[model samples]
Target chain A: EFIRKLWEGLLVQSKPPLTSHFPFPAQIPPDLVDKLERLALVDFRTKQGLECLEKAIRFADQLHVVDTTGIEPMDSVLEDRALYLREDTAVDGGCAEELLKLSRKTVEEYFVVPPGNIPLPKKEERSSMLKHSEL
Target chain B: MLGLTLKEVSLAFREGRISPTELCRKCLNRIKKTQHLNAYITVTDELSLTQAQESERRLQRGVPKGPLDGVPFAVKDNFCTKNVRTTCASRMLKDYVPPFNATVVQKLLDQGAVLMGKTNMDEFAMGAGSTDGAFGPVKNPWSYTEPYRTLAGPEADWVIAGGSSGGSAAAVASLTSYLALGSDTGGSTRNPGALCGVVAFKPTYGLLSRHGLIPLVNSMDVPGILTRSAGDASVVLSVLQGVDVRDSTTVPAPSSHAELPEEFDVRNLCVGIPKEYHALGLSPDTRAQWSRVADLFEAAGARVEQVSLPHTQHSIVCYHVLCHAEVASNMARFDGVEYGHRSSMDSSTEAMYATTRHEGFNDVVRGRVLSGNYFLLKQNYQHYFVKAQKVRRLICDDFRRVFASGVDVLLTPTTLTDAARYGDFTQEDNRTRSAQEDVFTQPANMSGLPAVSVPTALSSRGLPIGLQLMGKALDDHRLLAVAQWMERQVGFPSIGVHDDYRQCSDTSSTVQTSA
Candidate 1:
């Protein structure tokens, strides 16, 4: 209500109220529900349930900057976003599958080890995983 | 001449060897001889004499004021002194004298360090070289002086005394006064001290009171001292360190009284050298000197080890962002509202504010302020400002982790290269050199740790190279302990009278004739 009054005072048209219409149960993305839950983590987008979309938009720009000298915005839906959407859609292991694909592709494209390069021994990690010998 | 350290001068007054009047006269004489060095902004002759008389009478009546009693010292103009002009080396405060003394200055006065004068600096302490002062460049006092010392013609060699604290550094280097006070946010104290061949010590953040020093970057700026020796720096610091209610940042750490473990005790002392600091841009002479310093530590029975401060490489960039952001915010208070120079313009009140600031600040300060505002734009703030703050945290954590690994102190070269020609780093590529120059020093400021730069060796070109000793957070005394030991070993020669003239003229290229 405060936002509506502020927008009106600023001579701005109120954005159309978000439709309460629900998607078909069969058409719902597997990750859609999880994405809606994740939106609660973001203070601004908690009530709107739009954090997955926000990350989809923001992380895309970050990925571009890291990938192509800050140019060449990606065309296809990124695997991370797809994984987030899958988690929201409640698909079985769909998020994990998409995440694996994203990580593998990112490693291959951005961090491939170059030939004839000597790599230093990795310093000991402080993580508990290193202590437990898990995975 | 008033040839005494602040402590020594106080002792002399106690012994009746000389009066404060005589000491002030000697400082005045030195100021006259090297007037061209441009070290001072305002000389407080009357004020100094009055203070001197008070100190003398106290001594005569079997009462002594303090450790720095009857000792003359100069302050960087940025620090407010009651009823005295505190310009911050800019025109904005050219005629502005504050009604109160900065807390640090007040503390020093209460301790009896007589204020001889206010010194010159980079306008708002923005430049590395003192060339950006509203007054002008402060010539380095250690120029080559040889054959035919007295030249009447319009020819002589001269260079800058370092920047920000260049005036204070010059004063101490020439023995014009025993010690001078300056502020260092980034490399202001250490850089100028390296160039001028003096001892510059920046204590742990919040250790010294900063209530009166005009804010450059509130989080980064700390009141530091410039003196002739590490011992003197330590003595002055002893008097100054305490928790002040005025500066809320002051920590509750007790004054450092415990002596550092002897250098020979290899049982626990570990000195960590960050691999990132040994980068390619360091001068060959500087590298050799650093190796020599490391070798000395090894000989003294200390275990030296290589440590990786991965975040160290990003410290300078992060420091610039955070400092400039704070500067933008702090300097906005100077918009000619209650005091300071106000400019008249045809535009609106807001436009007048813009014009006043544009005309009031020098180019270097204006550039940083503008760049800071640009970085703080709503969309870009998260990308640059937030990232920089996060990186600053990471840099601090790196030091904490390094110290946690049992390294008591860190060693690095004070500067990437020896001091350059006056205008060498003053181009559009200033950021490249500026960032690179503070490569070794900024992390300490970021981490709020203590660091000191002491002259280690003279380069092939006759300029001094400095070695930096950085201690764990709030372990300032230990840093001084290691520095004092190193200072005694290196033993850089004191500056001579003719050196100043040689640096300012073109013909100052030859070796010293006398000595």
Candidate 2:
């Protein structure tokens, strides 16, 4: 229903499809669907996102027809090249001091986020979560 | 003074014929003269002059950083430059200023290369025609004489400076800068470089540091260079290399591969022309040019043959899936809390995130982000994302097998045609056009191989036609050496504003020999 509501009027009808309609729909449970879609952005698909997404789905479906049965999932093409790695140690990236200034709320030089998984007393619990930027 | 190549400009700077200040003024003046081209996002006029004067003083003291010292260059908007509003031609970063420079920019500054400004690009480097950026499309500097039946408007005659790095290509073509840095996920650098009649080089993945480059598809993204010739590209490449702790993907420079050789031998080398690249959509002129280039190599004593990578058709589909998924994940960092555009409307933090993203992102970015989330969903993950990645493995293996067969490099057209005119180019919606144009360039990025696009000939109307050369992962030096030889053999006139550049000038002569 979330996607059905969002998909109705969002796509541009002017051009004939460069590709066919996707053969399979996202087969997730209805409840989990909106939750993940929410994480991507609001499900409305305004700003041509719905069209953007529709194209990807159609292309992905086109790719799905080709048999990729035994192929291993590829990751880290660099790891294939035998590249050298820097040792893990703390170094100044100049992010904290500069970035903290942009946050609307902060506490004692640390940027603050709304209450979520972590309890306020334990700073280590928050520190343990990985930063997406680092990845 | 007006039409000198990057090497000639460097020589002039050294000989005291032109001071860095004078050189920068010339660049600024050139940019001013061609404002309709819309090549830059910001022009850094006073700051450029200040930096140029410093370089001039340093040269007077008899200590210069390197060959690039006192040279002026532009950077694609995607690369972050400190305090110099590094917008990726998107509203999200429309007013955001970086606290630090991208590693490549810092490296150039260290070499005393004057920063001219950030050039325009597709929003988040997502589009192919450089026409989709927030600042509007970059116009091709080439004489736009083509009267296409499908094209329209006041700029109808103007060919599109190929995109997402369209600004860089147009800038170098217009003589706004000596060289410009652009990011290539598939063919962003080379496409525009080809369209604008210049040399564009995408280094082997991870060779140049990606620390400050705004992420598009991180796995495929590499910092690329655009300049007047292959030799200038080699000069810029040596400066912008080295590992960074900030970006773990970068490999430490093996000292031997850093510098390109002065000369390369074509004798006894093997070149492959993939049969799959000879698709129906390739124009007759492009097809003939490909064969003529192969003949040139054969005549010069290198072995050239038709090779097959049957999986080529599936690459664009696989590339879209993989590229969209990564764009979704990378763009997640642009929420309202810390940096970038924050929404004014508030309900809860959830509403804030949604509104900010809706307001901040354009249709192209939001679409990919949404689809990425859908692909990564637990139920769809196996069917879409993983399958695409697995196909990527096949693509990688294709290059590996071909290289294993002793074909040192593969040759292909950089784009299907010469610079596309704006009206005809935009008539096809973004995604369709992007897919078709990227077909020839995607394999190199997908496999992490080095690729460079150098002008082979001009179109019937004076626009550039680029031919690409792909090489082994770390053998960038060798690839450039071969490209340099091709450059020497063609003697393709390097283009600029004041010079009388002709359309398809050499094709008349080559057509006689090949036909």
Top candidate (DockQ): 2
TM-score of model 2's chain A: 0.48
Docking class of 2: incorrect
lDDT tens digits, residues B152-198, model 1?
12343355566668898888877788888888888888988888788
C-alpha RMSD by candidate, in order: 22.9, 10.5
* Candidate 2 structure quality by residue, lDDT tens digits, B192-265: 98888788999999889898999999889999999888888888888887787777888876566444566677
For each candidate in turn, the interface RMSD (Å) is 32.4, 11.5
Residue B510 miss distance in model 1 (angstroms): 25
CAPRI-wise, candidate 1 is: incorrect
Highest-TM-score candidate: 2
- The TM-scores of all predictions, comma-separated, are 0.75, 0.87
Query: Which 10 successive residues of model 2 chain A have the least lDDT summed?
Result: A126-135
B-chain TM-score of model 1: 0.92
